[model samples]
Target: MMGGSAYENVGKKWDLGVEEQEWFHGLLPRVEAERLLIEDGDFLIDDDNSILEMVNQYCLSGRPWLDNSDIVLKNPIFREKWLLQNDDIILDRKLGKGYFGDVNKGIYKPMGNAVAVKTCKETFTQEQTKTLLTEGRILKQYAHPNIVRLIGIAAQRQPVLIVMEFVEGGDLLNHLKKQQKPFTSQQLIKMCDDIASGMAYLESKNCVHKELAARNCLVGNGLVVKVSDFGLSRDKVVHTMSDKNKPIPWKWSAPEVLLNGK
Candidate 1:
C-alpha cells in the first residue's frame, strides 16, 4: 500500500483541518479541481489525497502517478466573480422581465461594459432565492464563446443582481421573428453550429440544459449565437423527473421528455 503523509487519508474521513481552509475543496473530481486552478501557481487541495497546482503550462499534482493521466488546465477560476457591490452596477432600462425578476440593461462600472443585470423579486421565498443563486454558481463554471458569460453578481443589498454579457441582438426567438430579411442557409447553419457547440461543451461538463430552446439563446454581433438562460440547467448527465407539477416548455421538449418527464 502507498504509505506516508500522502496516502494517510485515502479511505478515512477528510481531515478537519483541511476542510477549514478556503483552498480545500473536499471530494472534488479531477476535472473540477483543474477548472478551479485557472492562474499559474493556483492550487487547491481535494479529497483525492493530492494537491493539484497549475504551473503556467502544466497541471502537476502532488501524486502525479495517481491522477495526472488526462486533461489540462488553461483558464483559472475567479472566486471574486461570485460577490459584487451594488454600487458597481448602474441599472438602466429593462431589457426583459420574467416570473422571478427583471433583467436590466446595465453598466458594470468596474469593467465599464454593458451587462444584463438580473434581479430577483423582493417577495422571493427562501427556495426561490437559492435557485437564483444556484443558477449563478452553475453559470460560473462555464466558459465558452458560444455560451453567455457571467460577469459577476451584486448581492450585497436588497436587489441581488446577476451581471452577464449583454448580447446586442437579444433573444434568438425574437431576433428571428423581427428580422427584415430571411436568414440565408449559411446564416441558419452557423446559428445551429453555434448552439450545438455550446451544448457539446455542456455535455462534456456533465451538465444538462433542461430548457434548450431558441427563446433561451441570445444573438450577439455578427449574427453569432450563444446559449443563455440557464436557470433550468442541471449539472447531472442523466436527470430523472420528480417534480410532476413543475412547468416546462412542452412545445420545445423532446418526445422522451414529454412522455417520461425526464
Candidate 2:
C-alpha cells in the first residue's frame, strides 16, 4: 500500500482539487488503489492525466466507472500497471501465428514459470496497436478460473507482447481430434459444460466473447478447459463495427452477427 506521503504526492502531482481527490478516493478505495500502486514495479503516477479526469467525471456522476465506456477509452493507466519488462521474458518456441500476432512459449524470470508470450507483428498500424492494448486492458479486468489469465504486457518494446498462463494440453479442437483413446460421452459433456460455464460467467459480467469455438478454447491438466482470445470481445451487448471491420468467420459467428454486422 502507498504511504500517506506518497498518496499526498499523487494528489499534488495530478493537481487534484479537494472534491476531485475525494471522488478519486471513492472510485478506487484508498486501500485497494494503494495496494495496486505499490505492487506495480513501474508505477508512474504522471503518465496519464486523461485517466484521472475520467475517474473524476465518473465520481461526479455518482456511477460505477470501472466497466464503463469512459474508463475503457482511458485504459492506458491500467495497462501501464501490468506492464512486464521485456528483458524478463525469454521466448522459447513459437506456439502459433495469427493475423495480428504470433504466440510463443516463454519463461517469466520473475515468477520462474512458463507463460505464453503473444507478440504483435512489427508492421502493425497505430490502430492495430491500440486494439492490442485494448485486449490487454480487457484481460486485466476479467479474472476467472475458466478463462485464460493474462499475466502482464510487454508494451515498451517493439512487437508488443501479451503474457498469459500457458495451457500445456493445447487447444480443444486438436485435443479432441488427436485423442489417443476414445472418450466417454460423459467426458464430452463435461467439456461442453466447461465452455458453457465460462460463457455464462461472461454473460453475467455483461461481456460478449464474440469469438467462441473449439479452436479458441484451451485444455489444461485433468481436462480443464479455458476460454481464450478477447481480441473481438466487448463489454456491452451490442458492438458497432467500423467500416474496415474484417469479415467474420461465418462458421464460428452467429447468424445475426454475420447478417447485420453487429
Candidate with best TM-score: 2
lDDT of 2 by residue, 148-234 (tens): 999987765566788999999999999999999988998988888888888888778877776788989999988989999877676
lDDT string, candidate 1, 1-262, tens digits: 2223222233333353443333444433354566666654355554434433232114323333336453433232332545566677899999999656998999989888899989988788756765676677678888999999998765544556788999999999999999999999999999999999998998898777777889999999998999998776666543466689988887766455677666
Pairs that collide in candidate 1 are: 38-75, 38-76
Q: Give the whole-model CA lDDT for all candidates, comma-separated.
A: 0.70, 0.68
**Where does the lowest 10-residue lDDT sum fall in candidate 2?**
20-29
In Å, residue 77's CA in model 2 sits off its true spot by 8.9
lDDT of 2 at 195: 85
**True lDDT of residue 213, candidate 2:** 83
Indicate the TM-score of model 2. 0.69
